[model samples]
Target: MSLFERFEKSFMPNYGTPPVALARGEGSAVWDVDGKRYLDFIGGIAVSSLGHAHPALVEAVSRQVATLAHTSNLFVHEPEILLAEKLLGLLKDPAKIFLANSGTEANEAAYKLALKYGRREGRRYFVAAENGFHGRTIGALSLTGKKAIRDQFGPFPVEVRFVPYGDAEALREEVTGECVAVFLEPTQGEAGVVPPPDGYFQAVREICDSTGALMVADEIQSAIGRTGHWFAHQADGVVPDILTLAKGLGGGLPIGACVGFGEAGTLFAKGDHGSTFGGNPVSCAAALAVLDNVDLEHVQKVAAQLRTGLEAIEHPLLKGVRGRGLWLAAVLTSDVSAAVQKAAADAGFLLNALQPDAVRLAPPLVVTDSEVQSFVDAFPKILTEATP
Candidate 1:
């Protein structure tokens, strides 16, 4: 039996079954089990920040593993301390961090902090934007506003109020004084790279301030230089009380962090929470390498090239392109996103159909100019071939 068939018979049905069975990757390219090479535009759903098998990432992980692979939270390690300091430096704020194993765990930690802070003030309600995705864990899932995934989970553990995204008035109206915190994504990744209106976050910040609610920004897919900024919320020029990060932060390793600022930073007292393998030495080292190697200027240039190329496409099936930096989505005139994804895959390129009409592209930050141009040139042809 083929690898795909073997996977279907053995693995769980959560992800269904992906068509390609990749064996190895280098830079912005990956080879399937059968040795078919494809330009990877998805970047493992924006997790591979420096691209696959980057020399720096490989070396860092190797060196760290040789020295020390992991030390539970009961012990303190230099790599974890260094990573936390570096993250605080990048954030340009004084904050305390709780490390975890993934974005979901980070958000879960943030949620618990918010819950504890709320309980102190007799607050019982939380707020989140409609269509915003936090994570799959219970606390994070309760904050997630997507009904399709949330409905089946059945009666979450918290009372969360949802507001229309980009609508400052609705958010202001919904986030009353009873709200403990408001969770939002600076740019919605799973919802097809949707960015809110300019200054929308500023309004949300103001609302949170007025209502005495903590502002939690889920920058899982938009942080670590993904949007040509250290953090997507930086574009809004506002500071969130709690910032959750993952995805590209570890460069490919599994790591997540919940950073709390000011009073929120002190909300989690000793013995409040802990993680056994959250800040594994090897993962922290890999993250340090990614932070050292990512070129923000080059990433911005590539993002501009992608946006210009997509906007310049004159195909009738193409509608428009949206999103910032390398985190982009191509809107189709029709619901042919699945076909477009398949055609692009067949044409030796890989991207994601975030919706029936939205194709998402979040290539690695180290993706070369030529690689992006190749995708630009092939996009129209893929759309044409996929059109019915």
Candidate 2:
């Protein structure tokens, strides 16, 4: 039996069956079990920041594993401590950190922290943007505004006001004194890498201040120099009270962080919450390697090249491009993004149909200029083949 057959026989059907089984990879490229090579523009859905088989990440993880692997929050590890300090330094604020295993867990941590803050302050409501995605976890799902994934599980106890993304006035209107926090993504990654209008986050900051609501920026997809900044909100020159990160942070290993500022930073008292494998040494070391290697200027350059190349293609299916830096989307004239995605795979490329109208292109940060040009040259033909 093949890999798909094995998967069907043994595994649960949550993810369905994967189209291709990748065996090995090296720097913006991967090979399937059939030995077919493809340019990996999807970058494991924006998780492979330094591309595959990076020397730094491999060495760090291996070395740390040899030294120490799991401490179980029963003891401290140098890598975890160093990783925390480095993240706080990048944030440049007085904040506390909680490490976890995935973006969902990181978001869940922030949600729990906000609830604690709300209990003390007498404000329990939250404000979130429509089409924004937090995670699949119950508490995080309650604040997620997308209707499809959230409909089955909720009637959640938490009251979250749903508003249109990029509309600051909607936030100002919904975030009343009774609202304890507002959850936002600088760029709505799962909603097709959608970025808001200029000065939107600044307006959100002011609104949160006015209502005494904590502003939680979900940077799970937009942070760690992917947007040519350490964090996307930095582009708007605003700081959130709570920030969550994961995805690219571990360079493919599982790790996540919830960073809180000011009062929210100290909201969790002892014996409140903990995860057994949260800050394991190996993952922390891998995160450190990713941080040390991500180059902001290189990200800006590669992004510009890819954007210009995509815009230059004269295809009816492609409407335009949106997003900043390495995080980009090819907006289609028709809702044929799935066709385009399949066409790309057939043409030896890998990307994502993030929405019906948007194909997300999040190549690794280290994607070469030649690779960008190669995709550009092939994209026109790819689109031509995909058109209905």
Candidate 3:
């Protein structure tokens, strides 16, 4: 049986069988089992920040594995401490961190912290935005605004109030004194890379302060230099009380973190929470290398280039482009995003249809100028062929 057929029969149907069975990948490129090379624009859904098999990441992981790999929460390790210190330095704040294994776990840790803080402060409600995705875990999923995915998993642990995204007034209304926390994504990634209006986060911060609610920013997809800035909220000059991060922080390894500022940082007492492999030494070393090797200035330049290139595409089927930095989406004139994605894949370029009208592109930070130009040149034909 074919590999795809075998996967279909054995694996759960949660993620439908992918069209291509990838064999190996290099910088900004991958080859399928049949050896057809394709420019990877999806970047493993914004997880491969340093690209496939990046030398720095490989060496760090290799060296760490050779030295030390796993040390449970029962002990402290040098790499873990260094990674935490590095993240705090980037944050530019006196904050405490809780490490985990994925974005969902990071958000979950943030949720539990908020829950405990709220209980102590006599708050009962939580506020979130519609169409904002936190993660898939039960606690994190409760904060996610998509009804289709979250509806089935009802009877959530907490009572959450959902408001319209990008509406400051609506957020203010929902984040009353009864609300303990307001969870939001600086840039909505799963919702096709939607960005809020200027000063939206500032307004949210103000309301959170007035209502005595904690502002929690879920920077899973937009953080770690994905959007030109280390954290998307930093662009707005706002510091969230609690911030969750993952997806590229480890370059490719599984790692997540929940950073709490000020009093939020100290709310979690010992034994409040813990993880077995959260701060694995090997993953921490890989993350340290990612931080060391990824050039923020170069990433910013590449992001600008990508946005400019996509916006420069003039086609009947192409409506416009949205999003900041390398995290971008080409808004289509019609609902042919899936078709365009398939067409691009057939043409040896991989893309994602985040929505019926949104084609998301989040290439690795290590993508070369030539690779980007190739995508730009192929875009017109991809859209033309996809448009019925």
Candidate 4:
């Protein structure tokens, strides 16, 4: 049996069966086991910000692994400290970080903070927007608004109230002092890269402040220059009390963080929370490499260019394009996003159907103008074949 067959037989049925068995990747491209090369627009679900086989990431990981790989949280490491300091330096003051192994773990740490903070204020409820995708863990899953992901895992701990996304009035009416936190994503990535209404984040920030509730922005998919900003909340001129980050933060390594600002940072006592492999030196080193080599200017310009190019496409079946920067969702007039995804893949490109009506694209930040042109060049043919 092949690797795919072996994987299907050995692994749990949670992810279903993957279509391809990838062998290797370089830059914004990958090759399957069958040697079929593809323009990797999905970017490993937006995690490989600098693209696969980036020299910086490889060198850093190699050096760190040769020096030190795993050290329990018992001892201090330079990479972890430097990463925390560097990340905190970019944000507003009085920020503290809790590291984890993945986005769900980061959200789990934040959830612990909320539960502890709620106990202090005698509150047990958490508020979040509808269609929001936080993570797959139990605590994060509870805050997630998607019914399908949560229907099987019932009886979550926190009482969660789902408000209509981008509706400030609904948030204002729903948020109470008894609420622990109001969670939101600046752009709902998994839900077709939906960008919230103008001033929505600012309004949510105000609501959270006035109601003595913590505002938690889950930027696992939107942070790390994905939206042409260090943090998507920055675009809205709003800052959250707590932020959860993963996906692109480690530049393809498994790392997640729960960052809290001001007194919120002190909520977690020494024994409150911890993770064994949260801040592994190799992961931290790789993340530093990504941050060091990332060209913010280039990422911003390329994303703008892509948006313009995609919008200018004269395809009738293409309804609209939503989102900012490299993060984008192509809205189709008909519910044929899966067909479009397959068509793109068959034509030597890779993309995702985030929803039946929306196909999402999050290419590597290093994707060049030529690559953008190639996708634009090939997109028409792909859509023409997919559209009925």
Task: State the lDDT of candidate 1 residue by residue for 1-388, as single tens digits.
Answer: 9998999999999999998899999999999988999999999899999999999999999999999998898899999999999999999988988999999999999999999999999999999988999998888999999999998986888799998889999988888888999999999889889999988999999999998999999999999999999899988899999999999999889999999999999998899998999998998998899899989999999999989988999998899998999999999999999999999999999989899999999999999889989999998899999998
User: After best superposition, candidate 3 residue 357: deviation in angstroms?
Assistant: 0.8
Query: Which digits, one per residue and each the tens of the lDDT, describe model 4 over residues 61-128?
Result: 99999999999799899999999988887775679999898999998998889888889999879999
Q: Estimate each model's TM-score.
A: 0.99, 0.99, 0.99, 0.98
Q: For model 2, what is the C-alpha lDDT against the true structure?
A: 0.93
Better of 2 and 4 by lDDT: 2
lDDT of 1: 0.93
Residue-level lDDT of model 2, residues 174-256, one tens digit each, is 98889989999999988888889988999999998888999999999899988889999888899899999999999899999
Collision pairs in model 2: none
Which residue ranges in model 4 land beyond 4 Å of their true spot?
Answer: none
- Scanning candidate 3 in windows of ten residues, the lowest lDDT window is 302-311
- Against the correct fold, how does model 2 do in TM-score? 0.99
Q: Lowest summed-lDDT stretch of 10 residues in model 2?
A: 309-318
Q: Report, for every candidate in turn, its global Cα lDDT versus the true structure.
A: 0.93, 0.93, 0.93, 0.91
| lDDT string, candidate 3, 257-335, tens digits | 9999999999988899999999999999989998888878888888888778888889999999999888999999999
lDDT for 148 in candidate 1 is: 94
